[model samples]
Target: MPEDLPIGRRERLLAALRSRGSVRVRELAAELGVSLPTVRRDLALLADRGLISREHGGASARTSAPERRTDGPRWVVGMVLPSLHYYFPTVAQGVKAVADAAGAKIVLRGSDYDPVVDREQIGLLVARSEIDGLIVAPELRHPQAPEMLRWLDALPLPVVLVERQPPSDFFIEQLQWVASDHRRGGETAVEHLLAQGHRRVGIFGTDNVTGMQVADGWRQALRRHGIDPDEQLMGRTGLFQRDARISAFGDVVERVRKGTLTALIVQPDPDAIALAQRCLEAGLRIPEDLAIVAYDDEIASMGDPALTAIRPAKAQVGRLAMEVLLHRLRLGHDAAPQQLLVRPQLIPRQSSLG
Candidate 1:
């Protein structure tokens, strides 16, 4: 969305197709200071190169119009993310950079955290896009996850999970994936706090796969230090719902006041910031009265105390997942299932250091 996006004519044309899902030759010609015939020629070359499909009056990305030149891109991939916002955009950038450079087509979609929507968007990609592979971060924690995962396993295409590892309780054969080591991130958070002489630690995260993983690590780290990972200290609530967070703030404040909790680990920057604000209102000093560690360091420093945070290698996960899917596509069903984990790093600031 830069002001100079329309500069490189061919690259710009392709980017337009990718972003808008289609582009008419006339509009592209007028926008690019070129003639209709020149645009048509470029479109033909691109179609022949397999980068796009030549439509009746325009060009379309694979997601909008089926491919006519299957011989262009080495592979056509469909990517389904949890959402288009937050941490996933960086991940998508990594995926696209690799794919575009490698002459591979990728169709991107967001599921908004709903498993049903995830499956539906994926269905459209499969049925209309003619994708040869998939890179997805699905809602694997849903009740319908078992069925949806089974459905995915049955697909003829190569599939790689990004930022999500399949649940072990299920019987789906080994799935290829690349994910952040969030469990270790949680462990690191606790270790940092405990090393600072805090024993009565706690966790508060949004109720999701990530929260669960971080909490799991917190428990492991605490038990290793002979401290109990009490249920009272770790709790899950909403990421965006202000009402739910207000109630959680009251509960957490009560615990801090009663001396049951001295430090906390919170996932996501916004929730952590919100918690810090609530603590300020209650006259509880960060790190002095309540040390904190936040997971996902996107804007974590914006908090009043400049929170310590866990930074996941989001772009690395995306790039690696895309690369793995390309390998899978080449090897087909004979390829070994790959599960890769990237570590998350802890950034210490006033929140925990003070």
Candidate 2:
């Protein structure tokens, strides 16, 4: 058998230890075709389990059956998100699919885009003591975000951040997160618009972390293409704040009429649809006078003239977050923290064709 195979490493090590009474680390590394560090780590794990006695440079098998405590209790994961309806149900469904396959149960809770509520929901789950791990999508741009991160970092159980990430300056060694590449999604939208001969572009985003990332991508893309970015063309409003959009409509129309704003990349499909409606009412033809690209793909296709959109791999983020948390639970302290960023795809439609 090939020595490099990992499937039977532990069994082979135990057999060698039993037959020889002791196995040198160098000999074990050579026999297993693994590094000395790998052998040492295995030995340490085995020693902790009472499976072997560690010597200066080797290990010896125990005469009695080893008291193994490597296996962990079955996992029950808690999931908390800011919304149950928009942009999160599909993610939740993906998490549920993985949990079901692993024979694990999920305790789910919803928050109303408030960091305080998010903390409360998480506290409720942690108080139960049955939850082995957690998957959370908290409002990371809120005023209490720093405090929340500190609290989450000190939790007893493992946590996997979903959709949201820590602030750029904050660093935690054991923090794990999985998020969509929203910044790249923004850049892609701008590049597509530039490809379509849009020299002057604008971005309408929400006042949230995802929106900020998209805007950052947009700014970076513009700089890369040597286009002078205009601050007047960039606008950010609160989520679900229709009055803010209404108040900005006049300025937007004036800019469109003056030929300063040729295209726009709007975050969230519903907001894009609303902007498109307003543009149409103002006598601007879609893809003719005003081209629009939406950030979220949800409901973008259903809009009039069908909007071009950046489709983030939301389901994959959820699935990977759950998988990472479960793997950490199984490995205990052996597993390393992981930060995964999945790319987003741009779907071109009639909205940006012109």
Compared with the true structure, all predictions reach lDDT values of 0.79, 0.81
Which residue pairs clash in candidate 1? none
Model 2, span 162-260: residue lDDT tens? 998887799675668999988899899999999999988998898777888999899999999998776438886532235663467777788889999
TM-score of each: 0.75, 0.76
Q: What is the lDDT of residue 336 in candidate 1?
A: 80
Instruction: Tell me the lDDT of model 2 at 354.
Output: 70
Clashes of 1: 0
* Best of the candidates, lDDT: 2
Candidate 2: where are CA atoms >4 Å away?
1-73, 237-246
lDDT of 1 by residue, 80-164 (tens): 9997989999999999988887788888999989998888777666544357778988998878888777667655456788999
